[model samples]
Target: MTDTKYRKKLLMALLAAVLMAAMLCGCAGDSGDGETSASSLDGEADAGNRDNAEETDQNMELAGSEIGREFTERDRDSSYTESEAVQIELEGNSISADGRGVSVSGNTVTISEEGTYVVSGHLNDGQILVDASDSAKIQIVLKNAEIYCGTSAAIYIREADKVFLTLAEGSRNVLGGGAEYTDTDENTVDGAIFSKADLTLNGAGSLEINAEYKHGIVSKDDLVITGGSITVNAVSQCLSGKDSVKIADGVFVLNSEGKGIKAENTDDSTLGNIYIAGGKFTIRTEDDSLHASGSIVIDGGDLIVESGDDACHADADVVINEGTVLVNSCYEGLEGYRVVINGGTVDITASDDAINAAAPKNASDTGNQDRTSRQEGEMQPGGEALQNSDMPDEKESLDGEPQNGELSQNGKLLQAEELPGRELPQAGGMPEGELSEDGEMPAAGGRRGGQMPGGGDTGRGSIENDSNAYIKITGGELTVTAGGDGLDSNGSLFLSGGTVCINGTASQGDSVLDYNGIAEVTGGVLMASGSSGMAQGFSSSSSQCSILRVLDESQEAGSTVTLSDSAGKTFLSWSPAVQYSCVVLTSPELKLGETYTLSAGSENLEITLDSIAVSNKTGGMIQNMP
Candidate 1:
C-alpha cells in the first residue's frame, strides 16, 4: 500500500486493454479475406488442369502398320483379234512360213513384223522367234503346234513391246525344251517359251509345256494370264515373271523341280508382285510354290499346293482377302513380314512354322563369310558345253542362290540361275563337311534357315530370329495344322475380328502361338492349342480378358471344351479343337472374378476369381500330339 504499488497496477491494466483492442480489430476487419483470395486462385488452377487433360486426350492415337495395303496395279484388259491367221509348218530341219511377216531360215521361223500367225505342225529341232518393233504387239496362235528345241527355247521372243501366246479353241499344243541349252556369249535361253518383252498367255484351250532345261515360261517383263487351261512340267521353275505375274482366271497344273510360280525382280524392289484374282491351281514343287518379292494378294481362288518349301512366300506383305488355300504339304505354309488374312478358308499342314511372319532371307542370310566370288553355271550332261548358232550373246548366271540384288530366273535377258542336279531332294542329303557349290547347305534347319551346302552363304532355310514380324487378322476362317509354331509372330500379334482355329501341337519344340511382342485379342475367336513350354498367352495390357487353367487331370484329345456361366448359359464352346496339357483361354466375354464351369468331355473345371477369369497355371512340357 504505497505510491510504487499504485503505479504498477495502473501500468498492468493499460497493457491488458491494449491487447484486447488489437484482437478485436484483427477479428472484425480482414480475418476471412485470405480464404476468399485463395478460392479464386484455386479456381484458376483447376481450369488450367482441365485444359491440359483435354489436350492430352486429343494427341493420343494408335499407329497403323503397312501389312494390309491394297495393291491396285493390275491389268485386266486383254482383248486381241486374230486377223489373217498365217500358217507356219515345220518339216525336219526347215520351216515353211506362210504368214505375212514370217520368214524361214534353217529351222527357225522368224516373225519380223507385227501380225497374227496360226502355227500348226511339228518342229523336231527348231524354234519360233518373234523379233519385231519395240512398240509392236505380236500374237501367235497355236493350233495343235508341237515344237521341240534341242538347244534353245521352243518359242523365243527376242524383242517386242509384248507378245501374246494364244491357244486355239479345241486345239492341243505342246512346247518342250532339251537338257543342254545353247549358251550364247552373254545369254542362255532355257525355258520352253522365253521372252525378253512382256508376255501374256490367254485362251480357252489347253497348252502343255515341258521345260527340261530350266523354266517353263520366262518373261523379262510382266507376265499375265487372263484365261487358259495350262499344264507345266519344268526342271527348275514352272512360270517366272520378272516384273510381275498377274493371273485373273486359269486352270493351272504346274509341277516344278524348284518353284511353281515366281515373280522375282531383285533390281527393283517394287516390281516383283503377284496378284491372283481367280484360278484353280494344283501345283507340286520341290521348292516354293508361289513366291514373290514385293507382295502376294489372292482375291479369290482354289489353290492346292504340295511344296517342299513354303507354299506362299513373299518378301513384303501377304494379303489374302478371299481364297480357298489348302496347302496339303509344305515346309512353311505361309510366310511374310506382315501377314494379313482378311477373309479366306485356309487349311495348311506344315513341317515348320505354319503361318510365319518374317523378313526376307537372302543367299547371304547365312553367317558364312565366303559369300562373294562364287561362280555358278549350267553344265551339260557329260560336263561339257555344246555350242549352237541360235544363242544370245549375253548369258551370265544369277548365282545358284539369289543374292537379293539381281533378277535370277529369266532365260531371255537375265540368264537363269542353273546348277547341276537342281532336281535332287536336299533334306539331310549333304555331307557334314561338304557344302553345295551354291554356298548353301542342302537342308540344314527345319522349315526355315535350311543351310546351303559348301562355303556358300545362302540357301532355303528357317528365318533367323528377328523382331519385325507380325500377324493381323481382320476376318477369316483359318485352320492351321503345323509341326512347328502355329502362329508365330516375331513381333506383336493383333486381332480385331476372325475365327482362327490353330492346331499347332504337331511339334514339341514350338508353341501354338509364339509371339515376341504383345499379343492383343480385342475382338476375335481364337482357339490356339499347342506346346505348353512356349505357349505364351495374351498380354495383360489388353482390354477385358480372362485366363483359365484346368487342373486335377489333363483333357484328352477328341474331347469337347465347353464354357458356361453360373446360370447355365453357354457363352463359348469348342469341340475337338486341339490337343494340349496346359491351356489358357482368353476372351472379352470373361467376367472378372465370376464363377464359371469349363468342361472337356466328362472332365469338369470350376474356377472363380476377381477378374474376368482365374487360374492356377503351371508350365508343362511340349509334346507332339497324335
Candidate 2:
C-alpha cells in the first residue's frame, strides 16, 4: 500500500465520526415531543400558548352554552315503558288517574311528583297543572289531546328542574287559552303552555296553539324546540323566552299582532339570545319578526318574514353563518349593533334602511316599542334640535354636526371636535341629486365630517377605535331594494367577499351606500344606484377599483345599467326598480389603469379606471375628484 492511499482512508473515517456526533447533538436539543426544551429561552412563549389554549376553552363554554343546548337522545324520547310511566285519562270536565303522583279535581288534573305521565284525553274546559318539587324533572307526553282553558293556561308548570313536553309520534294536539289568565300565584301564566323552568319540546307530531290574550308559549328560562310541526297564533309574542330561545330543527308557522319570537333577558350578558341551528320559519308579525336583546346566531335555517317593523333585530350582534333569509316586506330589514353575514342568500325589500348598524336607545328593551323617528322637529337622543331647521349658525364639528348649535341638516347629532372655517349647508344634508338654485347641490362626497343620515356618536367610539356599529359581509349574496339608504352603517362597512346589489331611494335624504367611518370593498362585486345628491364612493383604503358616476338626467326604473370592457362584452348588469341619478360599480374583475364602457339606458360613457376610487360627474352635474 502507498502512503497517499493510507492517509485518504484515515481522513474519510474521521469525517464520518464528526457527522455522527452532530446528529446526536441535534436530537438532544429537542424535548422528544417536538417541543423545545423547557430550560431553553422559548419556555415563556410555550407557557403563554398553553395559557391561551385554556382561555379559549373557557370562552367557548361561556359563548352560547348557557343560552341553549342541542337535544340529546333522552330529550327526544317520547315513549315510556309501562313500569316507568303514570297513566292519566281526561274526560270532559273530569279526569281519572292511575298514578300515585296525580290527583283529580272537579275539572282540573294536577301532577305533584316527578315522573313521566302519558296524557291522552279531551278536556272541554280544564287545565293540566304540574306542581312538582323544584329539583324534580317532569315529562308530559301529549297524544291526540285537545285541551282548552277558559281563564288560565292549558298546561302550566309551577316548579320543576326542567319540563319536557313531548308530542307523541303521528298524534295531533290542540291547545287554546282564554283572554284572561286566572292561575296567578308567584308567577304570571299568560301563555297556553307556560313553564317557569327550562322547557323542551320535541317529537314527530304536530301541535297548534291559539292564544287569545298574550303569548303562545312562554318560558321564564330557556325554551328549546328540537322537532315537531308547530303553528301558533297569538295576540302578543308567539314565543317568548325570558332567558333564550333556541330551535334546533322544527317547522314553525307563527303569526302575531306584536312580535313573532323574542328573548327578553338583559340582566346577564350571556342570556337573552336566540340561536337557530336548522329549521323552517314563516313569520308574519306587526313588530319585529325575531328580536333579541343580547345577540342572535343563525347557523342554518330558512326564514320568510313579512313584518311591519324590522325583520330581525338584536341589540348586540346579528350573525348569519349560513341560511336563506327572505324579507318580502319590512320597515327595516336587518337592524343590529353589528350585522355580520358569513355565508347566506339574503333578499330584502324595505321601506327604511335595508341593513342598518345602529345602536338602539335602550338596549334592554328588546320589544323596541318606542323607537324614535328621524323626522323634522324631532330631537336626537342626546340633544335638542330646531323644528324643520337648516344648518346651524355655528362652527361645524369634524363629523359635520354643529358643535355649539343643535341642528344638523341630516337630523343626526354628533359629539366631535370642532373643525372651523367650513361653510354652511354641508354635503349629505339634503337628498342625493336634489338641485339648488344653481342647478346642482353641494358635492356629496367631499363632506368634512363623517356623520350623515342618522350617524351619531352612539356611545360607541369612532370607526377606527373598535366601534360597535359595523356591517361585515365576508361571503354572501345580498340584494336590497330600499326606499331609504340601501346599506347604512353608522361606524363602518366592510366587504371582503360577496355580491351586493342595491337599488336605493330615488328621492332625497338617502344614498345607495352611506357610512360614517369608511366603506372598504377589498374583494366583492358591488353594483349600487341611487340619487346623486348624497352619493358616496368607496374609500381609498380599498384594494379594488370602483366607478362613481352622476348621470346627466334621471334614469327611469327598469333601465339596465351595464359595465362592459373595451371589447363591448358586458361584465355586470342590473336594473333598478326605482329611478336613479347616480351609479357605483366595483368588482375584482375591474383592473386599475384600464378603460371600460358604462351604459345606462341610451346614455354611454367611456370610463377609465384610473385609481382605486373614482368619482366622476359625466352628465355635467358637478365635477369633483377624490
Candidate 3:
C-alpha cells in the first residue's frame, strides 16, 4: 500500500483508540464512525483526570506558598534612583503630609494637596487618602511604614493627575486591608491600594500588601511597576490596571483567588495592553494567571505560574520576545488569536491544548457579506456525520442564508456551506473592509458583530476567524505536556527556526501538532509523539525528518528514543512522558542518502533520509496554504 493509504488506516485506528479511552473515562462516547458526537462538542468537559488524587491534593495545598522549581531573589541596588527626599514623620495616632496640604483625623491622614511626601512610622486601623487637584502630580515615599486599614484602602488616591508610590531604600513596609470596605462618598474602591489616576510603583525597599477582600493594587488608568521587592496576597485579584499594565523590573510573588494580573478595558481597544520589559513573577491563581483584552507583549521576564484556567491569554495577540516561562499547571497553557514566538524558553503543563491559536467562530465576519455566501439549507447531503442528536449551544447566529462574508473554521472565507439548522431571508449591509495579512479587518472595517470572548463587547475578537490568526515560530524552545491537543492552530502554522516537543499522545479529536490550515516547517527541529489517528506531519519541508509507526507494545512512556547515522553519529534523542504509537523526528544533521537507525527502547529500525518523509501529505479536513 502507498504511504498515504497506510497513514489513512493508521489515522482511523488511532481514532478508534481515542473513542475507547473517552468511553472508559466516562466523559464521552463515539459516534458510529469513531468520531466525537457533534452534539457534545459545545459543552465538552474540560476537567482533567489527575493521575493521583493524593498528589493533586498535596499540590493544591502548596500552590500558593511554593511557586516554580527555583526560588528567586532580587538585586537590591537597582531598586531606585537618587532623588529629593521630603520627610513626613509619623507620631503615634497622629500623622502628617508635612507642609504639603494635609490633615490628620484620628488614625486616618487625608492629603488635600499635591507634592512629594516621605512617610515613616506605624499606624493601626488607619489609611492615607489623597484627594488633590485634578492636574496635580503626587508622590508618596514609604520609609519603614506599616499601615493597617479596618474598612478601607490603606492608601487611596481619590483624585489625582498621576501618583507615584515609592519605597525608601533598605526599608521594609506592610500594607493591609480589611475583609470589607466602606464606600468613600460617591467613590467605590476595590483594592488595598486603590487609585483613580495614573499610578507608578517604584523603589528599593521590600513591600507587602495583604488584601482580605478584593485586590492587592488597582489603578483606573495606567499602572507601571518599575522596581521593588513586592509581595501580594489577595482574596480576589493580585494586580489590576484598567487602561494598561507595564512591568519593567521587580520581584513579585502573587497569590490570588480570581486572577494574578488583569488588564481589561473593553471601552477602548487600544488601551488594555500589557507590556513586560523585565521582572520576576511567581504567581498562583484560580483563574487566568495573566490576561489582557488588547495585547500582551513580553520582551523579557521570568514567569512561574500556576492557574486554574489558561496560564496566558490575550484577545488580540500574544508576542513573546525573550523570557523564561514555566507554567506548572493550567487548563490551557497559552491562548491567543495570534501567537508569535520570537525567542523564549517555555515549558507548559496543561489539561487541554498546551499552545492554541484559536479565535471566536466568526470574529471577522460582519455585515450581510457573511450571510449571503452560503447555500440555503440545513446540513448538506454528505453532512450526516455532522448532525447532532442534542440541541446545539446558544450560538450567535443570523436567521438566513449567510450573506455577509462567512469565516470558515480554517480562517478562510466560506465558499458554499449550509446553516446547521434553518435558513431564511437575508438582512444587514455590506462588510466594511478587506481582511489584512494578520487576519484582522482593516481599520475601516470597524465594529459590527457580536461579542468574542475575553469578556469584551467589541465585535473585534480572534484574528483567526478574520483570516489573520496563526502560529508563527521564528525562534524559541517550547516544551509542552498536554492532556488534550498539543500545538494547534485554527489557521496556518509556520516554523522557520526553533525546537518544539510535545508530550501528549493526542488520542482525542486533534493531533500532537494540529492546524486547520497549512503547516510548514522550513527549518527547525520538530519532535512529536501521539496516537496515529491525528499524528499529522508538515505539509512541506526543507529539513531532514522521519515519520515512524510502531506497535503499541514497542513504545512506552519514559523509554528513551535515539537516532544515529551510519557513522554512529547521534542526531536526535528524546523521552516522552506518555506512550505513543507514532513518532516524528527532524534535525539538521540527518542528510539525504545517509542511513540512520532509530531505537525506541528495545525495538530498532534503519532507514535513509531519502526514504523517510520530510514533508507530510495533505488530507483530513485542513485546507491547503494559499
Q: Which of candidates 1 and 2 is the stronger one according to lDDT?
A: 2
lDDT value, residue 189 of candidate 1: 73
Tens digits of per-residue lDDT for model 3 on 1-626? Answer: 01111222222222222211110011122224332222211011001101111111101111111111211122112233334445665665767654647777777787776767777898777888898989987778888998888899999999998888888788899999889998967878989999999888887888899999899999999888888999999998888998878888899999988889888886866567677778999999988888877677778899999987789887667778799889999877887767778788989998667887655222453311121122122221122222222112222122323211122335432321232222211111112222223222222113212111222221102111223446777788989888666777655466777898888743423357665444556667777775543445554333434443322332678888788887887778899888765566666665655666777666666654443343222111111110
| lDDT tens per residue, model 1, 145-261 | 899998899999989988888877777899997898986435567689998999888877789999988999999988888777999999998998888888888899999989999
Compared with the true structure, the alpha-carbon lDDT of candidate 2 equals 0.68
Assess the local accuracy of residue 513 in candidate 3 as a C-alpha lDDT between 0 and 100: 66
- Regions more than 4 Å wrong, model 3: 1-86, 89-93, 360-466, 506-510, 541-554, 590-595, 608-626
- The window of 10 residues in a row where model 2 has the poorest summed lDDT is 19-28
Q: Report the number of backbone clashes for model 1.
A: 29
Scanning candidate 3 in windows of ten residues, the lowest lDDT window is 40-49
User: Alpha carbon lDDT of residue 585, candidate 2?
Assistant: 82
Relative to the true structure, candidate 2 reaches a TM of 0.75
